[model samples]
Structures are given as C-alpha cells and as structure tokens.
Target: MGNNLWKDTWLMTVRNIKTTLRNPFSFIPNLIISAFFLLVYEGGLSGISQLPTFEGANYLAFILPVSIVSAAIGGAGGAGQSIVKDIENGFFSRLLLTPASRLAIVLGPIIAGMLQLVVQTLLIIGIAFLLGLEVVTGFGGILFVLLIAVGWGLAFAGYSAGVALRTGNAQAAQAGTFIFFPLIFLSTTFVPYDLIEAQWLKIAATINPTTYIFESMRTALIDGWVFWDLMQGVFAILIVCTITITFAAVSAKKAVSRG
Candidate 1:
C-alpha cells in the first residue's frame, strides 16, 4: 500500500509539472512580478544599510532571504490558483475518480510550485551576484538558505493548498498571499529587530516566524554559523509544515469526496 501510494504521488507530480508547462501563462506572470520586486529591493533600497544596524554590510544580503520567501509565497499562490482552475474545469473531479490518494493530488501542485520557486531563487541569487552582492558564507550558506527557503515554501504551499481545496475558487485561494506579506514585512527581514520603532509592527514582528527565518539566514550569511539560531528557525518551519500539510490533506480528502 505504501509503495502504491508513493508511485501514485510520483505520477501525480509528473502530471502537475506537465500541466504547469502547458499553461505557462498562468504561472509566469507571478514569477515576473516577484523578480521585479527582487530587483527593486536590491537596487533601490539597498542603500538604506548606511543608516544603522545594516551599516556593516550591503542591504542586499539582508533582503535576499526575504525575496526568496516572497518568491515562494507568490509561486504557491499561483499554484493554488491553478488548483482552483482545475476544479472549475472539472479536471480535479476527473482526477478524484481515479484511485490516486487525495494527499498526493494536493501535494503534486505544491511540489511543482516549489520547484518553480527554487528556480526563481537561483535566478535571483545569480542576479544579486551580478549586481556585486557578496555572499560571505559562500557555498555552504547558500545551500542552507536554499533548504530553509524550500521548507518554508512547502509549508506555505500546504496552507495555500488547503485554502484552495476548501474554497474551490482562485480568488479565495489567492487570499493567503495577503496573510503572509504583512507578517514578512513586519519582521526583521529588511531591517534589524532593534531598529524597528513602530510599536505595532514591533509586536507583530516578535511573533512572526519570518523573523526567526531572517535571523537564521542572517547568522548563516553575515555572521559565522550559529547552530542554535538555525535550529530555532528549522523547528518553527517544521512545526508549521506539519500542521499545514495535515490541513491540506484533510481538505483534499474532502474535496475528493465531494467530487
């Protein structure tokens, strides 16, 4: 049974990739938007580093992880939209009629989304390098950041997938995008935590998981590797992923049943 489920998952993933390639217009727009933000942030606001906590380094390094997260979140939103489109077109219903596991069906699109996000991240990082952004931690730090970004992508994708499955509407599924942006911007992604003066934003940043993620990436990239800080970020992401994936699985089951 486990083997069959694994095989079904692989097949579903392949199908999802094929669909994504066939409908590139649906996903490419989000990638372009994310790339635009990455460029603007790196080029326009990087000079802000001369202000305070960011003085010792270029602000592009600080903002890189945030850009990665943004890319992942945007890609997940697009994937959720694709899921909603499939539902609307009755393709999701046809898939449900097969013996494939509902969890596999839900995860397939998310996996494809994450793959796209990874490609976007690589491209962005290359662009940053071309713009004279230096990676202090070198290859190891880059690998670590990529892993964490992908983990966060999967977690967010799972949550978005759940929303998509529940609503069966692209607009509703896309709403998850709004939920994360504030959480991400309010955190220590662009500026240091100590530099934040706004009471409300400070409060929000303290509770936002993105803060931990940024801290982890910061320590890995800017400073020497710190295991404890990295562990904290990893733990937070793992817990969130577990919860969100469970939610997605349940929602997918329900959607399959209803279909």
Candidate 2:
C-alpha cells in the first residue's frame, strides 16, 4: 500500500509539473512579481541596512529571503488551481474511479508545489547574488533557507489544495490564497521585530508565523547558524503543516465522497 501510494503520488506530481509547464500563464506572473519585489525593495530600502538597529550593510541580503518566501507561497495557488481545473473538467471524478490512493490524489499537487518552490527560490537567490547579495553561511545556508521556505510553502500549499478540494471552484481557491498576503505584510517583512514601534503591529508580528520563518531565513543568510531561531522556524512549519495538511486530507476525503 505504501509503495502504491508513493507510485501514484510520483505520477500525479509529474503530471502536475508537466501541466504547469505547458501553461506558463499559471506560474509566470508570480515569479515576475517576486522579481519585481526583490529589485524594488533592494533599491528603495538600501538605506535601511545603515540604520543602527539593522544587522547588515547589505539590504538585499536582509530582504532576499522575504522575496523568496513570498514568491514560493504566492505561487502555491497553482496547485489548487490545477485541482480546480481537474474537477471542473471532470478529470477528478474519472480519477476517483481508478485504483489510485486518495491521499496521493491530495498530496501530489502539494509535492509539485514544493518542487516549484525550490526552483523559484534558487532563481531568486541567483538574482540576489547577481545584485551583490552574499550569504554568510554560503551554499549550506542556501540549502537551509530553501528547506525552510519549502516547508512553510508546503503548509500553505496544503491550505490551497484544501480549499480547492472543498469548493472545487477556481475563484474560491484563488480567493483563499489572497488571505495570506496580509499575513506576509503584517509580519516583520519591512523591519526587525525590535525596530517595529507600533504596539498592535508588534503584537501581530510576534504572533505571526512568517516572522519566525523570516528570521530563520535571515539568520542563515546573514547571521550564520542560530540554533534557537532555526528551531522556532522549524516548529512553526510543523505547527502549520499539522493544521493545513490535516485540513487537506479531510477535504480530499470529502471530495472523493462527493465525486
């Protein structure tokens, strides 16, 4: 059963990737937006690093992880959109009639999202390097950041896939993803936690999972390995994945029942 599940998941993931490749329109816009954010923020906020409280002189390094994480999570909707398309076109129902594992039916798109997140992250990191950003932890740091970013993105991809399974509506699934935009911005996206003056915003950022994730990525990129922060980030990912993946599994079961 485990081997069959893995086999089905691999097949679905491959199909999802090919489907996404054939439709550049689905994923290209997110990359463009992420690139634009990296360029614009690095240029406009170059002065921020000079602030007394800021960690490094290179603003791009400080902000590059934000761009990577944003790009990864922003594109997570592609998985759900694919599921919605499958449902709308009757493919999902036909798929339900097969011997494929239902869990893999839900997980396949999410695993595809994880692979896509890695690609997008590496591309963003490459662009940052071209713009003079350097990681203190070097290649190992890059791998660490990618792992964190992909893990966090997996949680979100699960949320997106859950919405798609529950609603089977592209618009609804897309709308669900938009809810994360504020979560990104409300966190310490623009400044360090200590630098935030607004009490409510501070409270929000303190509670926001993105804040810890960002700090973990920033630590790896600029501050070397900080065990506590990295662990906090890992914990955040696990917490989110627990909730969202469970939601996805329940939604998938419901989808199968209705299908």
TM-score of every model?
Answer: 0.91, 0.95
TM-score, model 2 to reference: 0.95
lDDT of 1: 0.78
Per residue, candidate 1 scores C-alpha lDDT tens digits across 1-259 of 4436677778877887787789888667766766676688877887788886765877777777787777777766656777888898998888787777776777677778888778877876777677777777899988888888888888888888889889998778766668877857878766788888899888999888878887887777777577897777798799889998899888877888754
In candidate 1, which residue pairs get closer than 3 Å at backbone N, Cα or C atoms, i.e. clash?
A: none
Model 2 C-alpha lDDT per residue in residues 166-240, reported as the tens digit of each score: 999988987898877776888888778888989999999988888889889988888888899778889999999
